[model samples]
Target: MKNIWISCAGIHDTLRFTFHSQLKVMLTVMNRRKLLLAFLACPILAAAPAFSHEGHGVSHVKTSVTLRKRRGRTLHLIVTFLNQGRDAVMLETVAVENAQVLNAVKTAVPAGALVEAPVSLRFHDDVPGIFTLMLDFGEHGKGPVTVTL
Candidate 1:
């Protein structure tokens, strides 16, 4: 076999072109992966704030009552107040049936705190089986809670 001389120039060029084409395909795949990851992250980014502030932004006070005693037309109550706002609240006054009594010692409820106060309601006619109590939390807010008879 005499020295067979063959030109490898076309082979080298083909190899170089294949390598560049593969590189371009790899870069395109990488870009697509990045776009897919970004699309998947959108919902998680939007829901992050909702999960962090769950059950928050409640700016008003909540009130509940328990009947301590009932004698004739008078109903003694133990009113419970829950301040959900950021600032403290004061129970300024309580009104029932045209009678309003200013709290001598205002009940103070710290932020996110609960306080119980003794309240008496005297009905001139007849004490109903169930009644609604309206609480005045000064400038904070008002809560109207129903009391079972």
Candidate 2:
């Protein structure tokens, strides 16, 4: 009877070990399948376009302004322009209220390229709350960008 009981205990232990090993393998395979499904769904999930800047003959003009610290009461304004178009476009001038246009220079830009044109405007005494920077494109339409500081 003692021998029979010892044999039964050994069999139960072996069964438990086999069950745990098989459960572990099943879980690992399930996790791997989930990871593969997630990886394959990435391109389908990212099919939509984020932002579209489609311009006609008149190129799209985007501007951004940044203010710098100055010694005197004058305020330094730096303007950046990005050309989102296919052809080359030129900027005529930039206007600001109560501020003089210090310099207007065009940086190197390629065809169908986005470029940055920096313009510095300095205020002598009074600073305007709102100002406008008009960009002239000869054949294309003019883009008037407003800035408020």
Candidate 3:
């Protein structure tokens, strides 16, 4: 057997250079991750105010079925109109899908007040399933309010 000897010159310098390069790459990756997270959080922080505030918009009418009861083929409902805006609203028409609206809709809802009225809906056959009620607030807005019979 023969003995072999190897040189150890510049071994420490090579190891130090490799360690420093690896450390720099690790720090760069960590900084990039932090920057990405900060960018993602910017939009969420900006939209925080919108989520906290409720009903922050122009004059609009909100409708809901406060009371609902079924008797024979006539489904009686108490529709409540909430004027959340500054101006008053006049309910022009109230139409029920798959049913005939029997009551007249000429009620005036004052500003920031709630107005409830009796709405009688006559179905062709029988009161069945959920239905949608369409309301028209003249010059203000119009939308559909889902109601379950």
Candidate 4:
């Protein structure tokens, strides 16, 4: 290219303006990114309490009874008893109550570290709709865990 004589002061002014403009654009982008992050984090922070028990501590004996497998009217479930406490807790009465079960539920859960009870539910009606299953963990007194399916 052909060399053109430009004033030193003019070159300094041009560079200063370019640097300020680029800095302003970069600052605007950073601000937008920060605002977007705050917006996205608000809901998760607000909904944290709903998902977990923040105030309520972990239960000593946590029981979960859910259906493992289902074939027609016969439903199979594995009931899990988790002991979070340091002491060994004996889960006495681990029972399931539903409309399908005709006789007494076979809950032979002996006192141990971790207990799992396998249960089978036989439905009377051909078409099984929404049924409430109440799990009774007597003496352990954790909960009669209610489940709907």
Candidate 5:
């Protein structure tokens, strides 16, 4: 009877030690999981600016143009627009020489839309003069539209 009691007590001690060790391991694992979760959430919270600048429900317009001088008498112009407002917008591009309209291109952009159009301007090889490229955005003309020559 004495030996049996001693053996039972030893088994109880081993089980208690195992339970404590397992409890510590579980706590460590849970803590690591929480830290990883927090790290993953930070980038998602910081990405608001990328999503908010895409027109949204308001009218925000942006324009960019690239001009490349090609061989002979042709100039390639690539124009792009992003409408950030809730309303549709019309865009017109006019090439002016001494305030005189030489050539023009017109298009309409829907709300929250992006448009990239390429236009080619041909000038006579002997035409050596300064010209103005104007981007007119209807009544919203001067604002919201950018011109690159």
Candidate 6:
């Protein structure tokens, strides 16, 4: 066969052009993969925060009736509080149930803490059959739990 003649520089240029085209295609595929991954992860990234605590009206707050004392035309209640989460929780002063004394008392409870004493509450005149404790944990976290009558 007759010897084929080609310049060394011409060969190099053709190889370089092919390499650049392949590189460009690979880069485009990588960019598409990155965009797809980001799109798929959007929901998880915008997800609502998770709370360590779950029970009670709020995750961080837990309430119980330690003592219920009733007097003539008056009822006395002793409630307890506990925080099961790592962050502090704000407790509403007044409950959501009827016959509640709205004191608007707000208390910030530390995480992993418990109330030392029972909270004293009073009810005059008509006594409610059920007591509803409203809890606002913030971040769209709220609970309106009820105890016995």
Which runs of model 1 end up more than 4 angstroms from their true locations?
A: 1-59, 98-105
Which runs in model 6 stand beyond 4 Å of their true positions? Answer: 1-57, 102-104, 116-125, 137-140
**Candidate 3, residues 1-149: lDDT per residue as tens digits?**
22223334676766676676677778898999999999999999999998756443324677788557778888878888788877777888888767888985688988899889888989887677777887877765577888764
On lDDT, the leading prediction is 3
How much lDDT does each candidate structure score?
0.71, 0.64, 0.76, 0.60, 0.62, 0.60
Give the per-residue lDDT digits (tens) of candidate 5, residues 1-149. Answer: 11112234678876776677677778898999999998999899899788665434323777777765554556666777788787787776555333333344677878878987666666654334444455666665544333334
Where model 3 places Cα greater than 4 Å from the true spot, the runs are: 1-59
Model 1 residue pairs with clashes: 129-149
Q: Candidate 5 or 6, higher TM-score?
A: 6
TM-score against truth, every candidate: 0.54, 0.49, 0.56, 0.41, 0.43, 0.49
- Which candidate ranks first by TM-score, i.e. highest? 3
Query: How does model 6 fare in lDDT?
Result: 0.60
What is the full ranking by TM-score, best candidate first? 3, 1, 6, 2, 5, 4
Residue-wise C-alpha lDDT for candidate 6, range 11-123, written one tens digit per residue:
88767766776777788989999999999998777773443234433655676764466665345555566888656766655455445553335666677777633344456
Q: Which is superior by lDDT, 1 or 2?
A: 1
True-structure RMSD, every candidate: 12.1, 11.8, 8.8, 11.1, 12.1, 10.3
Residues 11-74, model 4: lDDT tens digits: 8876776677677778898999999999999999999988764223225667777778888878
Those runs of model 5 whose alpha carbons end farther than 4 Å from true positions after fitting are 1-59, 98-104, 123-132, 142-149
Instruction: Name the 10 consecutive residues with the lowest summed lDDT in model 1.
Output: 96-105
RMSD value for candidate 3: 8.8
Of 3 and 6, the candidate ranking higher by TM-score: 3
Q: Which of the predicted structures, 1 or 2, would earn the higher TM-score when compared with the native?
A: 1
Residue 60 displacement (Å), model 5: 3.0
